[model samples]
Target: MIDKDRDTKKLQWNIGTGVHYTLNANWALQADWKYNYHRNTGARDRLWGTRLIYRFGEGNKYI
Candidate 1:
């Protein structure tokens, strides 16, 4: 069961950051992190992620 009023009125804070680096014209890398804290429930959450990107076709068209 879930309480709609409590869920909607809950207090929380979230911080997030990410970075992107171009390895080359067609390749790139990215990483991210996030932190969440819930004041009402005393809950904490953390998330970390990474990504690899690639572009097709000719040279760098997104100069």
Candidate 2:
């Protein structure tokens, strides 16, 4: 038995999406995806990530 004015109040939400491809001037490739929602009790989460970029000694000069 526990119910001492329980009202913490909780709400969470998140969404994200990204993609960038530029296989030139050096090398660049990235991909990301994320989605999360937690309302009341219905909890759900999903995340994805991928990245492979490299640039050294002046690579991309606003190209």
Q: Name the top TM-score candidate.
A: 1
Per-residue lDDT tens digits for candidate 1, residues 40-60, read 889999999999999887647
Query: How much is the lDDT of residue 55 in candidate 1?
Result: 83
List the global CA lDDT of all models. Answer: 0.90, 0.87
Model 1 TM-score is: 0.74
Candidate 2 per-residue lDDT, tens place, 1-63, comes to: 245445566788999999999888788999999999998889998999999999998889787
Q: What's the true lDDT of residue 20 in model 1? A: 94
lDDT of 2 at 37: 92
lDDT of 1: 0.90
**Model 2, which residues run further than 4 Å from truth?**
1-12, 25-28, 51-63
* Segments in model 1 whose C-alpha atoms lie over 4 Å from true places: 1-8
How much is 58 displaced in model 1, in angstroms? 3.6
